[model samples]
Target: MDYYDTIILEYHNTILDWVIADKTTPIENLSVLDKGISDHSVITLEKQKPVKRTIACRNLKGLDDRNFASDIKKEAKNIKQLDTGAMLGAFNSNLRAILDNHAHLRTRTVTHRPSAPRMNEQIKEAKQERRKAERTWRKSGLMVHRDIFKTCTFKVKKN
Candidate 1:
């Protein structure tokens, strides 16, 4: 008996690219596999380089901690007194101060790194690996055994 045999390959190349890029921006080319033969057909794939973006750092200084704390306290008092507008204004001022302080502390100069491919490359590699595994299973007659294991059941006795 003659049976039609076919193989379908699908993959996302970003994951592999991310792995190769070391989880950094501007990922680079990722070479995973070469030409290979399967039970049905051969497969070939390549990963492209990733793109980088520029991130800017804004300077924030002159934030007074004492003033921030006083504002917070005043806002709390206003809130207790049911002065909604005043409380909201004070709360906004305090929040702005805190954010400014944090920005000042965390500020850093922007740096550009070489671009590399994103996560899609890695996904494609994974899919190719899966296809290879399936082909290997078919060649080794292991798929049938795996199915048997899936349907297996064992009776247990209570002690």
Candidate 2:
């Protein structure tokens, strides 16, 4: 059996490369991933079991202090009216309502912002916009435009 597998890793014709893989090691499954680096080919390896987590939140949007307090008291009364044998039983009776009332309790939506923009992105965008406008002004070649070179310059200090 040949250990080396030659594969042409071409991406949008922009990248034309080859990857020689040593297939001696056991690989459950190999699939080309949709995401990858500029010139590198990506493959997915199925190994670990997927994990799911449940988070509790409160959806108290548009409720003032007075109304919020009243809503809470009403939910508590509803739970008490369940007449279940135990606390857990009562919770199970109105589980959906309970979860709904507490959905907005935690500020995960506001606090847990995923993949936020970096400082470099803002600086780059500003620089690009400035450069584009400068180009347009130069192409018109009508009115004398002031030098816009120093408007969007950012100096990065290395850590």
Candidate 3:
């Protein structure tokens, strides 16, 4: 009976939608909302928990190093006929394919993240102003706009 809100169903004098939790539960801002579609109200609460992020990365532990080296050597011999830029492209593509076959990528979630306090409203506005100035300079191709863009960039960096 921790909920202080009024009953959800006025006619029935009861709360049909509700949450039952122990006192140790880490939640706040619990409330009942009326969405107009259903007679029972919607229960909502905010959990006090850190954010989590997932990132993909190669699993180097399972890599076949010997086969990777041999594949690179074989691909390099076939790229001798290409120009410098094409040779670089072939080398990159071959290397990526070899790595993919050896160390396949895996995604994992990261937890207990710290919020970014430095990237506040002021810093965000400065970065946005810098981008706007850059776009205007590029479109106008004028010296004044270019100077303004440079100044904006300097201001953003200083902050």
Number of the top TM-score candidate: 3
Q: Could you give candidate 2's per-residue lDDT for residues 8-122 as a string of tens digits? A: 5465657655555444444446566545554565756554333445565655564466755566567567664444577567655555554455454553323332242344575
Sorting all predicted structures by lDDT, with the top scorer first, yields: 3, 2, 1
Per-residue lDDT tens digits for candidate 3, residues 1-159, read 243344233343453554555443466787766789877767778876766889899978777778878888898888884488888988898888888888887799999654464667887999999999999999999999999999999988888
**What are the TM-scores, per candidate, against the unseen true structure?**
0.23, 0.27, 0.39
Model 1 clash tally? Answer: 23
Model 3: colliding residue pairs = none
lDDT of each: 0.47, 0.53, 0.77
Q: Number of backbone collisions per candidate, in order?
A: 23, 8, 0
Candidate 1 vs candidate 3: the lDDT winner is: 3
For model 3 the local lDDT of residue 156 reads: 87
- Cα lDDT tens digits, model 1, 98-140, are 6665454354445555444433555556555555555665677
Give candidate 2's error at residue 134 in angstroms: 9.5
Structure candidate 2, residue pairs in collision: 57-102, 57-103, 57-104, 58-102, 58-103, 58-104, 58-105, 59-104
Per-prediction CA RMSD (Å): 17.9, 11.9, 16.0
